[model samples]
Target: MKKENNLDKITRKEAISKMGKYAALTAIGTFVVLNPLKAAQSSTPPDDTGGNPFD
Candidate 1:
């Protein structure tokens, strides 16, 4: 039978740190991937021509 190794044992602090790091990395990755596309999208312009979809 194989025994558990010391390295496999994780302490409370290590677990918390790992979770925080993972959350930060995930946030950064999402921002890095989506921010550019969001910035490139054009905002709604004012309709000076006075035309409405209902009209």
Candidate 2:
């Protein structure tokens, strides 16, 4: 009687797929870390007096 472990078995297709996914994730992470987006800053907001001009 012989016992085989399925967890130790990996196909070539699966390995390539996993490698590609990891590569894509790494690239995206690198890009985000290197060049981050900055939020727009406003110096001052418009004033609202709430007064009617016809009054």
Candidate 3:
């Protein structure tokens, strides 16, 4: 039989943190894969900051 090592153990908080990281990556990957065109578009919003100064 093999011996268990304490160093191999992870706390619940650490596990949750790791899971969160993976979840975020998965979500981003899914978004990019499903919406490649959208993802490639510019993040900046259009110049719709209200009525024109001249108007």
The number of the candidate with the highest lDDT is: 1
Candidate 3 total steric clashes: 0
Quote the positional error of residue 36 for candidate 3 in Å.
2.8
Q: State the weakest 10-residue window (summed lDDT) of model 2.
A: 36-45
Ranking by lDDT: 1, 3, 2
For model 2 the TM-score comes to 0.55
Best-fitting candidate, scored by TM-score: 1
lDDT of 1 by residue, 8-35 (tens): 7999999999999999999999999999
Report the lDDT of model 1 for residue 36.
87
RMSD (Å) of each candidate, 1 decimal: 6.0, 7.1, 9.3
lDDT of 3 at 50: 80
lDDT of 3 by residue, 14-44 (tens): 9999999999999999987879677558466
Per-model TM values vs. the true structure: 0.61, 0.55, 0.58
Q: Is candidate 1 or candidate 2 better by TM-score?
A: 1
Candidate 3 Cα errors over 4 Å, as ranges: 1-3, 37-55
The residue pairs found clashing in candidate 1 are: none
